[model samples]
Target chain A: MFLWIIQRDLLLAMRRRADVLTTLFFFIIVVSLFPLGVGPEMNMLRTMAPGVVWVAALLASMLSLGRMFSSDHADGTLEQMLLSPQSLSLLVLGKALAHWLVTGVPLVLMAPVLGIQYDLSTDALLVLTASLLLGTPVLSLIGAIGAALTLGLRGGGVLVSLLVLPLYIPVLIFGAGAVEASAAGLGAGAHMSLLGAFLLASLVLAPWTAAVSLRISME
Target chain B: MAINWFKYSSPASFYSLAGKMIPFFSVAAAVLFVVGLYIGFFVAPTDFQQGEAYRIIFIHVPAAWLSMFLYVIMAMWSGIGLAFNTRLSSMVATAIAPTGAMFTFLALWTGALWGKPMWGTWWVWDARLTSELILLFLYIGFMSLQAAIDDPRRADKAGAMIALVGVVNVPIIYFSVKWWNTLHQGASVSLTQSPKMASTMLTGMLIMSLACWMYAIAVILIRTRAIILERERHTVWVGQLQEATQ
Candidate 1:
């Protein structure tokens, strides 16, 4: 059921490829703009790179969250899925994973390139990519709850940010912290471990919470 | 004597009960405020280090404690409302939010006041302050989510879900200092250890906390009564009560 939903969403996303690319472009542009805004000093840019990239990833992931279920909802497919005997949480999980695949993975792949733009050393770039790799799924997972809660509400785009951003702090802390720690010659292991913990815990918990939120929004 | 515990659980009953109870709590809160402040300012000895500026702890510590405490209580009320489909529980949760947010703002403001003289700055990105600011955001989110949904019941359930999800941050906020090395000091009044302050200072602080508690209850009960009236206005009893009052 999960794989089917992921495959189906992937095909749907393929049909509308611009939606995926928009998020990716937004991530790249936001990451690129930081060096310009904060002078092009290499050492300074290197120091700011991980945080800038991680924040852009957070925003890009959030920007695409509206598409997670609003399209299915508009077409009434969501209600049908809700009535399906298979667990709604599993379906929501699939949708969130699909979202991460569409939005999150691109940022993770693009981080090293963006990191190089900031003049991050090889090791720092690797840690930046690795941290986002471990962190962005948690963003997508937790964001599913916010997206579900604001599903049909007006001004939902702005409202979802207010609802979800505070919840994203721990991820932001540890995600950006991992790179900063690695750059400081502190092994990124502890921060990576914490990010991995967030991933595992959110994986177990967020789908069920988002599933309940979907039911609330739908009903 | 057999007592019916659920008697006041209904919005209708609780409305009148809260109305009667408000004055008592308000009075107690007023008295405590007077007494707590008296002791806080005049009785509690000045810190040898901080001198008079340390007195803000009476207000700051209590407000900070209440802000976090109210979030937990609000989430619990929300969880109960979601689980049992109880209107009153949800109303109480709704009513508690503004008070919680108020205390959060108070905590932050007083922390700034206290920090300027002590930390030599109005603010720092210390873990405790950051988490408290997030706590404020959580309150705003809960209230805004509820306000956005026109249907009270849907709003209740939706707010409950967010509240429960946000509850995970509370422990993180409480432990943020211990978890991270930051400018914020470790907890001075933890239950596991004897307080590391003068006895009079401790008394003043606890009394101020109790004053804040009484004030919060009075305000929340008053707000809950208003919420009850708003939600239950279509019912017969509320109309009759309205007629009686007029």
Candidate 2:
């Protein structure tokens, strides 16, 4: 049942390819704008590379988060899901998983392009991809809680960012730190482990919280 | 004796109860502040290392302590609201947030003012400072989420969730100094150990911290009363209470 829900969300997301493409485009444009705004010096871009990418990823994930539960709730699908025999927690998790697949995975895959644009080293590129791979899923999971809480609200986009950004701080610190550590040829393992622990913790915690939020918002 | 758990849990009951308690707390807070300031500023011995500049700790440490202490209280109220579905619990949580945020700003502001002399820079990405900055953001996020939702019940629930999720960050911030070899100093007044400072300095800091706590209670009680009235405007008690006030 959970797999079916995941498949359904994936198919729905694929059908709205424009939404996916627009989000990705926004990610790229926002990232590109950072270097332009900060100046095009390779040395400066390299120093700022980890932060710029992480910030872009954070913003992009937030842009996609409002759609996570909002569209489903809007179309009455969320109500049907809640009323279904399948547990709401599992259903919400499935939706969040699909969201990570669509939004976060693409960002991870596209990191090399972003890395090259920012003149990141080979080591930095590897670390950036690794951090994003571990980090962005946590963003999707945690953001789901915010998205669910603001499911039916106007100005949810602004509220969602406000609510979620603080939660994103540890991820931002660790993700960027991991890449910077690797770029400096230091061991990035501790940073990566912390990110993994964070992801694991958020995965365990966010789904139930999201389910409760959905119930609250729907009520 | 069974605790009157539900007695003060109702918004109407808490509203009236809070009103009765505010004056006492306000007076206590004012008295403590005057005494603590006198001791902290004039009576406490000068630090051999930091000299008069170290006097800022009287405000900085207390503000930082209250900021974290209030967040825990806020999250506890939020947790109660989420777990037990109490309207007053969430209202209390909402009432505590702005003050928590304000103290966080005060802590950071005073820390910056203190740091300029000690650390020789206004800001550094030092672990403690960074985590405190994140703490400020967390408070703002909680406030913004609550304000954005039009429905009070929904907003309370949403804010509770954010508060709960953000609570996990609090411990991380507290321990970040220890967990990583960061620039922030380890705790000087931990419960596990005798305080590292002189007795007079400790006395002054403790008095100031208590003053801050009393002030927080007074402010939150006052704010919660306002929140209860605003939220329960349609309730009979609110109308009667408004009439009484007028």
Best model number under DockQ: 1
> Tens digit of lDDT per residue, candidate 2, span A124-153?
898999999999999999998989987877
Model 1, A33-73: lDDT tens digits are 88779898988888888899999999999999999999999
Native contacts retained, all candidates in order: 0.67, 0.87
Task: Give the TM-score comparing model 2 with the true structure, all chains together.
Answer: 0.96
* Model 2 share of native interface contacts: 0.87
Highest-scoring model, TM-score = 1
Model 2 residue A193 CA deviation in Å: 1.6
Candidate 2 residue spans exceeding 4 A from truth: B1-4, B242-245
Q: What is the C-alpha RMSD of each candidate to the true structure, in Å?
A: 1.1, 1.7
Interface RMSD list for the candidates? 0.5, 1.1
